[model samples]
Structures are given as C-alpha cells and as structure tokens.
Target: MEKERGYNMQIPEIQITKSWRKSISMSFDTQGVLQVRAPKFMLSGQIDNFLLKNSAWIDKNFQKITQRIKNKKKYLLWRELQNLETISDLEQYFKQEAKKYIIPRCNELAQKYWFTHAWIRITSAATRWGSCSSKKTLNFSYRLVMSPVECIDYVIIHELCHLRQMNHSTKFWKEVFSIMPSYKIYENHLKNEGWKYTL
Candidate 1:
C-alpha cells in the first residue's frame, strides 16, 4: 500500500518518519522518494503547517523526483531480469563482449586517431571505466560493452588521448575534444547509465 501524508495544501507523495530529533527536516533520497523526518512529539498540525510552508518548493521539484524514481525502478527491473548471478558470470560476459566489440573498436579508433599504446587489458573493475598507465598500457572495464557505442568511443578516445598527455590537464581534454567534439554528451550518458551494467 502507498503511504501518504495529509496537509492543508496538496503536497506530492511523501513518506514521513517520526524521529527523536528536536526539529523537522526533509530530503529527497537517491531513489527520489521524498522523506520527511519529524520530531516524535510534534503534533500533526505542526507537520501539516510545515508542509504547507514548503509546498511551493516541493511542487517545483516533484515532477523531477517522481520521474527519477520511475526511471530507477525501471532500470532495477531490467537489471534483475538479466540473471547475472555471479562475479565470474559477469566477468566472462564482459570479457567476451570486450573482445568481440571493444577490441575491434579500439583498433579502429587507434588507427583513426593515430594513437599508440603498450598493451590493452580488459578488467572487471567497478570504480573506473578505463585508465591509461604511464607505460602506455591501457586498462578498460568489460561492463563498458553495455553502454552505447558513442560512450564506448568516448572512453577509447579519452584514454587514447592520454598517450600524448598522461594527466587530465587542459592538453589532455584538448586531445579528447579534437577527436570527439561532443564528448560531454557521451560522458554524461556514461555517468547516468553506466551503473545499469553492473551485476
């Protein structure tokens, strides 16, 4: 059943939790659920008044929060359906995907951008999508295969640029932009959707 709070003004969906704290507070969780934490001793009217006072702000952010929650639930269901049960399953899946798609694409981009590297290694790292060592060796995440080709290309170009400038100085970004004019678009895509590839 859906939990709701009643107030003088019609506020969006919210879940209220009673706490021992002295004051009332509110926030949107990562899943975009609006949560209100109120003093356990506070009266219902006081809470309603507080909600009324902040109704405008709530209304302003309501649509965005609800949409975020919907998108999160949708992705959760999609990921669950994949049945990726073990680390080895995820690793093997991504490794084969990297060999089939990432390696060939990397070769194509390297040729197009005239970049060189010592070696390429596909990894099961969760923290980073890719990295370039000072030794010119390249490391990539196998899960990257789940992202769009544009994001994959961005990661490739991003690391390949490191062949010239190892650090993320203006020169490094300049190298990335030279090959991918709209790199930020794909960059943001990876940031928003990359976690969906996880096991």
Candidate 2:
C-alpha cells in the first residue's frame, strides 16, 4: 500500500516514454536522478511531473503525459518508504523528518513576497512539492525536506506566486523570476534529483 504523505512533502515523479510495444525500467540514481530505460524510438523528458511549465502542447494533451508513468508497486522496502523515522536512525527520525526545516522557509518567503496564505500544509506525496488553490490554502509534500533547501525555496516561491497568477502565462513566470532569478537552475536541479520517490 502507498504510504501517507506528510503535510510538507510531495513525491517527485518522472516521465517515461517508450514504444507502446516495448517495456521500460524506471529507477532513481544515487545522486537522485530519474532514469527511464526504454527503446530509443520513444524519447522521454525528465520534468517536475507536477505541472509542466511549457503547456502549449501539454495543456491540450495533459492526460497523455499523466497516464504514462509507471504505477507504484503494491509494496516497498520499509527503508525506502517515506515517513518520519529514517531506516538508519529508525530510532530518531521520521521519513518526513526533513520538513521541520522547510515550512518556515516557505512561510518566510511567502510573507516576504506578500502572499496572504491562509495556512501551510505539509505532506509526503512523491508527486508534488507545493500547490495553491483559489481558497489561498497551500499544500506541500514532505518529500521536499530531503531535497536541497534552494530547491525547497523555489517550489514554495513558485506555488506562492500562483496565488497571484494561477496559470503559467508569461506574466506568471515573470512573477516567479522576480523573486527567483535563478529559478531555472533550481528547477533543473529538482528535476535532476526529484524522482527518487515514487508517488
């Protein structure tokens, strides 16, 4: 069964593309890379797997992307599972133990940028970092506590910007860049390491 996601974490998902006739292998790298083994005929792109930033073609065929990822296995190693206690320090930390360090930074940046966030919720879903609804409620995945702090900040700022602009229109990105000039770098960094956890 899938583990429960904590209030501040989300699992990172990766896209895998292969011929409908071929089988593929999806695995994470030690440095936290999302690797998809497939036939060359079907090329794959590693993205945040949350919302694709470039949506010209994606928006029209969104399901096409979402439907392709491999499903999570019914069971996982206790150590690989996301929770409060680490397998190593099974005695001391929870899988999402890292969130304690992330939420405050998110709030600080949101306040710094003038977002009227009603509350910050943390979770451990492997597919998303942060999300903002029209209600002004923010939801974050605890998996982020494992990522670099810069990446954590980027997701927070990205979602927080959504409070002002809900879509990825040029203006929305402008807001993201206003607060994070190196947003792209951190985005790539997240993509590079984000898919280790299965959602």
Candidate 3:
C-alpha cells in the first residue's frame, strides 16, 4: 500500500510493503519511487517512526536523483548529443571546441584583466571547471565552452585571479570583482544550470 507524508510543505509519496524480512529497510529506486519494506508483523507506528527518523536522508537523496534526471534530460536535448555516439566523439568535440573557443577567450580576458599566466590547457574534467597551479599554469575543462560567454569569462577571470591569490579569501574576491562586476550572476548560473552541459 502507499501513503503520502509532508515535510516542510513538500510531500513525497512513499510505498510500504510488508514482507518476511526481519527489519525495516528504506530505499529509493531508479523510477524515483521511495520504498519502505517492513517485517510482516511490524506495526505501522514503528514504520512511521523509522521514516520520520530518516526523513532528512530521504529528502536529500531524493532531490539528488530528481536533479540528476533533470540534468540528463537537458543534456540529451543538446544537438551535440545526437551526433555523439561514443566517448571518443565527445572527447574530440570538446578538444576542438576548447581550442577554438576557450583558449582564445582566456587570452582575451587575461589581457583585459592585465593578468599574466604561464599557460592555459583544456581538460575533460567532469566536476571541476577550472584550476590554477602554483606555477601559474591554468587548466580548464572543455565543458566550459558549453556555458554562456559571461559564465566562461567568469571562470577564466576566477582562475587568473588565483595567479595572485591562491586561496578564496576576501582579497581573491576583490580581484575577481575588479574584473567582472556581475560575476555572481554567472557563477550562480553555473551552480544551478551548468549541469546541462555534461555528457
């Protein structure tokens, strides 16, 4: 049988099944269903208590899966996904696009910001969009090209600013703000919607 529970005004449907199993177990499945399995003899009060105790965990994992599916759908909608049948095709596309776009854009921003770096290289990193090393060399993900021009410039300026300040402190932010006044808008975009660019 199934029931609904509301937490913080968000109601997540839960399905409960009684089985021969000895203990209560909670799980989430690929179809975005939350399931609670209980011993056939267990009381509903015990089951409700178990779910209540783990509500936070359920909320967190459920949101993660929901967002992941949304992102996958967004990624699939991109025209590039249609032609990309293999991993190598995706890699080659990123490399070529990075060379054509990311490198030249970084060069332009570095000049505008009066920043100097040893060099910049493009990568295929899935998580980190960019990084700067102690040696002043900058590495950026090819996926960055998939972002808006504002977001792309934000990432570049962020890494170049690291050339002066290695850590994310007030001084580092001052450097970034000096270049892009509205960077937070693009930064938030990267945090919220940037997952659409992933393969």
Best-matching candidate per TM-score: 1
Model 3 / residue 82 / CA error / Å:
6.2
- RMSD after CA superposition, every candidate: 5.8, 15.9, 5.4
Q: Which regions of candidate 2 are displaced past 4 Å?
A: 1-98, 197-199
Q: Order of all candidates by lDDT, from best down to worst?
A: 3, 1, 2
lDDT of each: 0.83, 0.64, 0.85
Instruction: Give residue 162's error in model 1 in angstroms.
Output: 0.9
Sort by TM-score, best first: what order? 1, 3, 2
TM-scores, each model vs. reference: 0.77, 0.53, 0.73
Regarding TM-score, does 1 or 2 come out ahead?
Answer: 1
Off by over 4 Å in 3: 1-30, 37-45, 48-68, 80-88
How would you encode candidate 1's per-residue C-alpha lDDT over 70-146 as one tens digit per residue?
Answer: 77777767656875543457668778988788888888899888988878888888979999999998888998987
- Give the Å error, residue 10, model 1: 9.7
Of 2 and 3, the candidate ranking higher by lDDT: 3
Positional deviation of residue 143's Cα in model 3 after best superposition, in angstroms: 2.3
